[model samples]
Target: MNGRSFSSSVRVGNWNEDVSLDEDLLKDFLEKREKGELLVQRSSNLNKNVLQKAELSISKDGFLHFGEMVMLLNPENSEQSLSNPSPVYGNYTLSVNPDESAIHVKSHLTAPCGVSASSNVKPCGRNAFIITSVDGSEPGEPLCYGQNFALRTTEEFMGHLYLTSDRKSFLKSSKKSHLQEVSLTDQDSFETCWQVVYMDPQLRLEHEGLPIPANTKVLIIHSKTNQCLAVLRKYILWTLFGKECEITAHTYLNGHRVEENENHWIIVTGNPSDDINTMFDRPKPLSEDINGS
Candidate 1:
């Protein structure tokens, strides 16, 4: 009706009447409907609007910025050995509410290593995350050490899936008693708040206001419980997608001091301007003492 030429004639009823129709338009509509292009086109348009609203950017200083898509990696176990084919070989990345669950159900948070299945497979991108400021900072603001932020899932359909630690998990008397179970929740409660800590002891004192560099190792400490977010190395579990590493909120302690290595994680992003090196070059202490807080 909009632009088609209605010159085609079609038989109508038994009155020998001729009806004018746009054959080309009718054919095009039928083809598009058969191929499901109409639904796809509408979905694509909606995604475009969502992407524009959630436009992410990087900082010139090569630091992790708020609202940027990132993958949390543990370098200690990132590599996969094809010859050995160990369950612990592949790189593990944090993921929230993976699509492995039943319809209308949300899965728990996990660190999936796609390469675990085969050495040829690349690390899974379902682990993508977005670091958003809990203090309502602008998206352009650089994420700094000791700043509180919320890790949110990037899936649009999942709505607001935030990384959260279950308080009830702390009461368990089993082997996992010290480890708080981490999961995805729609609520933005205190359990969703996490603070970034410098992994390097030197940086803890020297770099207070500097933005955390991308691909650098850092500690994510839960604000409410003062526990560090960690991937349970021994707790590999199977999911609908593949084998995934279990995540927890546990404070690794050597006597009264914090054990940094057990909870270390690297922030990986696709921002080309990021500095790939200098992850442990500097550090900053949390605004308040972790134990005292």
Candidate 2:
């Protein structure tokens, strides 16, 4: 040891192996870490708080609303709306008919001063229902009913709706089956059901290969060709120029997208304690009781 270090020389060792032997560079690196500039900072874009707007929602009481507009029967019992007052026209309340699996859209609005009421009413106009024809294969019509119209669902969430005339048949299979009003009693009638598809948060009624496009004039087209479904477009027909307009649903499809909004639909009822099975399964109509099967 004395021979090797006779001159007594000392050397300093560098501890930072990554740095270029510069103190300034090491200082700059440490400063960047403290300021959160060098390492990946928490990205706000990935963790942004986005607010969503209120969209179409069905209540437990079977009341469907798009924002402030409620879907219901026209006071005049008409099928389509042409001019004013149509946007706000609709039944105030819509409930599910346990006896018939269809929805009953009722209106309490008064008719025009001289306009006659076609449906029976107690001062108020008659009630209408959202129903399809016997065989959904063809675009069905929304007709006026007394108690309620018969509508049946083939599945949960993304399912098909069938309109029955005498609680024995449903409108199913748009073009393929030639849109015939086949009786549910027939096994082939099972194919008559329409498909409820929710795409981009918008609800669409599709039958076999045909799609029901929604428009302000009509909830759906009579066919894929965009023929408007024929119905009595009811209005107040009041003497007042402003009051003579019709009331109809302005929104049919969703303006915004939802993850499961269109794909899912639940049976709504006033009785919160109602059993799901009983609500859906009545004594007259069996689960497979499509078209009165």
Candidate 3:
């Protein structure tokens, strides 16, 4: 007689009844649940008013809009390599804080720099950043190409931090010509202003007056220096959050031979509902039936 094959889903006996969880296992599970360590659905804890504001800030088409919380992503550093062994591919977002002193550079200790050591002065040397419109447009207004904006830190305790590039910070090293340091300042000045430019120059006329799509690569130019904002992949700095890539403003030229990819950045934005819900939700109970009833 030929043997018959059974499907994996075929239930021959009461598996649930045959196996049982032990007392220690049950106790551990309960403890984890009580500590909110269990893998379970939870409700959001964000204030209703804040959630409403965030919802209003998001554009209908989901394009990057003014006043929206945005993170600038460097595409060149988005991948893991032998040099960049960190598994945080695409996770190293551009972030900034009020405490500008938190940035510690390895080269600053030895290099004879003209930068001032005043406590009041903060150099944009490899500091974190956040994107916002400088035009004073409404939060829901879409960011258009060639629009002016500021890269600011979320910290407002002392004052708003703006990413600034000026002629004084310009450097000409043996390797290339670029802005040596991008500093942070509490004051809003012309030096802190930057403009968004299309990565492909051909797209300029087509996308004029149109909203910039989220997650698309673009170039940011410092309005004052006329140099493109770039990430110094080789220059890593230590921050309170650990090691992070450095940022600078550089004009890439055929003569200078600077890599153009350094200037490319992607604007990343989160869904308003998801971000709000995750911050302020309550835990949801498990379903009564393991299998659909």
Candidate 4:
């Protein structure tokens, strides 16, 4: 105590080294902390707002007039946010049947992707159904397209329509099988008709009835390759009587309007000079159905 300078200390109170920096240093540290908290709060708020506004985004429907996507509007600046392309919706399918009775539609929804389908029943005249279906392989909301789906409708008259969707891979294992069936006839008839309908692309008839029968309500199809080739109509039966015109000439003479002794069904008629020649004649009698399995 006599030789050395002594230092006197009472007691040291609690002091944190980190908080006990110089005044300027302390202020700078506090500012940095405050700024970090502010940034986190702002980011969180932006995410909440974006989620709330997602429905208005173009991805659900389409792009807005300003060319901004819905999901990207509120995302914090990032690479994905900058280079993102516009949004797109998913796809679906719809189809109908013949005889104006049933319809089918389909769509799907998965963990990462979803789809839906619906359809409308309709009167598919003359032609047979081939299990017309829709496919939605793209992203976003599901939509559909038809086999003969053109912007311009090509038919004498459009009939009843049905809409449906069977997505989610829940309905059937369609993804597993590529083979499908389109049949309007009894199973027993499939074998006999397959020769006439399936194997033959031209529907080769073995000197058979061209106009079909009244009981023949549907043309059996393979549910694929629905094309327009041979044509048929009920009124064409009269043309057959032309070969018998000489035989039925007496009947025609009596039954036809005696004004010119011609067969006039509707309000229209052309010259009766061999008008029957314009119609196709049966090279063979239309007596039996086709042959083969």
Off by over 4 Å in 1: 1-59, 77-87, 97-101, 104-125, 169-178, 254-260, 271-293
Q: How would you encode candidate 1's per-residue C-alpha lDDT over 1-293 as one tens digit per residue?
A: 35423332434343232232345567888998776466555444433322232223334667898887666776554233444354465446665324332222222233321111111121233455688888989987888887888987666443557877755443641133345777776777787898888876555867666688876778888998888877665566565445666677776765647554457777765533244322322333565346432
Which whole-number lDDT from 0 to 100 does residue 218 have in model 2? 21
Model 3, position 201: C-alpha lDDT score: 65
Q: What shift in Å separates residue 79 of candidate 1 from its native position after superposition?
A: 12
lDDT of 4 by residue, 27-131 (tens): 876785676444445444333321221111122232111121111000011332356432111111111112201111111111111111111111112111111
Query: What lDDT would each prediction earn against the true structure?
Result: 0.58, 0.25, 0.51, 0.20
Q: Give the least accurate 10-residue stretch of model 3, judged by summed lDDT.
A: 41-50
Model 1 worst lDDT run, 10 consecutive residues? 113-122
Better of 1 and 2 by TM-score: 1
TM-score of each: 0.60, 0.20, 0.54, 0.16
Angstrom error of the Cα, residue 207, model 3: value is 2.9
**What CA root-mean-square deviation does each model show from the true structure?**
12.3, 25.4, 19.3, 30.3
Kindly provide the TM-score of model 4 when superposed on the true structure, using C-alpha atoms: 0.16
Q: Highest TM-score, which number? A: 1
Top-down lDDT ranking:
1, 3, 2, 4
